[model samples]
Target: SRSLLKLLEAKALIELSNQTKPPQGWPSSPARNLEIPPNLNPDQANVLQLFQNQREQKEWLLWGVTGSGKTEIYLRCCIPELEAGRSVLMLTPEIGLIPQLLERCQRRFGNAVVPYHSALSEGERLATWRYCRSGSPCVVVGTRSAIFLPLPKLGLIVLDEEHDSSYKQEAPMPCYHTRDVARLRQQQEGCGILLGSATPCLETWLACQKPNNSIGLLHLPQRIAARPLPPVRVVDMRQELADGNRQLLSRPLLERLSGLAKRKQQAVVLVPRRGYSTFLSCRSCGQAVTCPHCDVSLTVHRNSDGHSWLRCHWCDHRDEIATNCGQCGSTAFKPFGAGTQKVLEQLELELEGIRLLRFDRDSTRGRDGHKQLLERFAAGEADVLVGTQMLAKGMDLPKVTLAAVLAADGLLHRPDLRAAEQSLQLLLQLAGRAGRGEQPGEVLVQTYDPDHRVIQHLIAGSYAEFLEEEAAVRRIARLAPYSRACLLRFAGPQASLTASAAATLLNHVANQLREADWLAIGPAPAPRARVAGLSRWQLLLQGPPASPIPLPSEQILRRLLPKGVHLAIDPDPMEL
Candidate 1:
């Protein structure tokens, strides 16, 4: 309360009598407070020129390569708006990125840069929101929730890492995407929208291809230092099995890690999951232990003392390891697949005397855990950093001379249409983490499907070829990029009620489907049929590109849903 009041007092925002109007005049141009102009390549210069030339609200995709200086372009482009005495809003995908981004923004714009995100205390959030609303030229760097901030004089909006799924909000009313919301705000407020990503989402790429004139695509194909993209070595797990080397780390990765450790160079190990094991099964009954509240099997987690426990990732439920199998009353149990914890354990055993730091949902559960772990890894306190999906995006560790993906197969074979694209993006991003500094870096991807197209693309480091091949498949399947997609999920405590509610909604949607180009699929059980004791079902909607697909509004849907049942509608969903 004291902090909030003090801030309010400083701005004279607490007393109506002392409230003064904003400054008498808004500067027509920036004071050129940036000590020096950012150096830009020809391609970056062209993109910056386009952004500066936009007099009206427009949307553009800055599709740059992994180290192609996209952030530099963003910083340069945003300056003009700030100079014109208008606020700029920049959005990143995760809280883990806010610290680094905030640091850079602060260095560039000083106190004018306001950091807004859930990580801040309520007073800080309110102060930032009020500052942005003070009609002063400033920059607001934040996560998805920052979209709703009231920056009335906003002139430029940026969505970094646009391909990331974190931009999509899954709960509460108006579950809108950051990119979409930014575009909407641009339309309403007459601001320029810039979407930057190394591996652009298929939808955004396709949107850029549409001859909208106002929407442009800027390509930055080369890294800033002209460093050659790291060479990705695809290790076939099948070959390892045939060679009688059944280890999680491939021979090549093991050798590379050994060399890295010997040289005191840092390494990053990318795992697909977080717990010690994906699932555990009873050796006697061949039955997998499942979460009591969720349909998914319980993951095996081990504490520092090495005591094992079962945890439900969906509901945060914990259970002790049973001495006997529930089904057959047998003592033996077996773990199914490896996760980050398992890989960390294996690395310690295989590469002795290596200092390893683990970064994942479990390990980084504390408030400042992400920042602390990353700082330690960056400071050379740990030789190896083991993580899951969190390590794939927006993390630039220059000291990371070696990067390895334990298993790419975990990302593939998913029931989602964009699995292939996601897998490719993830591999390429992980590969890009290496070779960013003086020492040449390399990536080793271990996968069972060495012949897979995604693996082939990674090995070649040809994003164009991968996109063309993936686009062709998407076109043939009439899935995203070629079409617009939406997901409607229904969940309830009772299975019968959930099914009934889903069926009713499906029938209603079908009856209301007047457009011939629109299609709806499924009222079937979702990928995970039950979560937190709630039975779930899903419906998919697809329509022609750029066409609007109408459905019940939040108010109407809330009324239609059965008691205890809830509905979640995601337009252009990242997952099926």
Candidate 2:
């Protein structure tokens, strides 16, 4: 408060005004000002040149490879607007990015950074909001929700990891895309929107080419150190198992990982999901135990003392393990697939005397916990780290000489158009984790389809070519920036009511925007149709180039939903 008041004092906006009020004034002067180091690459500087807000309303898309320093590029553009005394709103798709981003912004910009994410305490959020509204907070770094932070002088908006699904709000009003929101806000406030990604979402790349809809294109094709993209070898598990090599880790990867661990170099293990076991299925009847409260499977995890416990993945409910299957009463229940926890157990057996750490939603549940765990890992207290998608986002480990994806096809089968793009992004990011400080990193992807085109493209390090192919597929499918796409989801206790309302809304939407030649799909049951005791129905809408669907997503949802029903709109949904 004192620092803010001092900045205001320097600007002559506020006088001492008696030097004392009952309780509403300065505490002390700014103590020990913080300095922001200039840590941006030369190519990122070139990007700042094109997007200085004096140029045309061109929303430039930057594609930076992993370990190529993309976050540094974002800060480069944000610095100028901040210096100009106008607020900067930098939106990130990942919730975990809040802390690292906020610390960097605060240290660099000093107390000017007001972070707003779900992680903040209620008091912190409210205080931060008040500060932003007063026009004193120069930088507002946050997750997708920060889009609504009151900032009239907001001059620059950046969407980092533009391809990530976290940008699309799953519930509540304004279920809008941060990228789209940033673009609209840029127009509303005359700011520059910089979209940065290692593997640019296919839709954004396609939008860059379309002169009518896009601003311009900026590409950073190489990593800062010009390090060769890691060598990616896709192991065919089918072949391995066929040759009687189904011992969990493939022979090639196991040998490589062993050698790396022996040298005391760090290793990161990427699994498809968290938990020890997602479900206990009876091999005979093929029925898996499920949560009675929600329509999702429960995960099996060991307690701190190492006893079995059945825990719901959706709800936090827990139950004692069942000796027999719930339906068949068969004693043949077994964990069919492996998660990070299960893999960690197996790794412990093979690689003894190696310190291992696990990072996932379960482990990093609180602020101090997250910070302490990261500090320990960064300080080399652990050798092998196993994690879920959280491993791919932040937490760069310089000594990580090897990164192994326990299962590469984990995200490949999702019913989303951007699944391939996301897979490539994860592979690129995970591969980038290795060889950051010159020790030469290695990435091993174990998949059945070793010759898949996505694997081939990822291994070749040709995301541009992959983008072209994915864009063509999208064009044929009539989705995304080629044609605008939005997903409408409805959930309520009464299944029929929710389905009926969503169907009615989509029908109304189709008639209102439907043309003689336009194309759209959905008004159907969503993938993972039920969550947390709610039967969910979805609508997928599209419009042609001549007819753009007016997206009053918030208004439309409010109007159509039953009073008790919940509605959400995901513009440019990563998951369909």
- Misplaced by over 4 Å in model 1 are 1-38, 54-57, 514-517
* TM-score, predicted candidate 2 vs. hidden true structure: 0.87
RMSD of 1: 5.0
TM-score of 1: 0.91
For model 1, what is the C-alpha lDDT against the true structure? 0.82
If scored against the real structure, what TM-score would every candidate get? 0.91, 0.87
Tens-place lDDT digits, model 2, residues 397-416: 78888888877776776666
Alpha carbon lDDT of residue 464, candidate 2? 85
Clashes of each: 0, 2
lDDT of 2 at 284: 74
**Runs off by more than 4 Å, candidate 2:** 1-45, 48-54, 494-523, 545-572
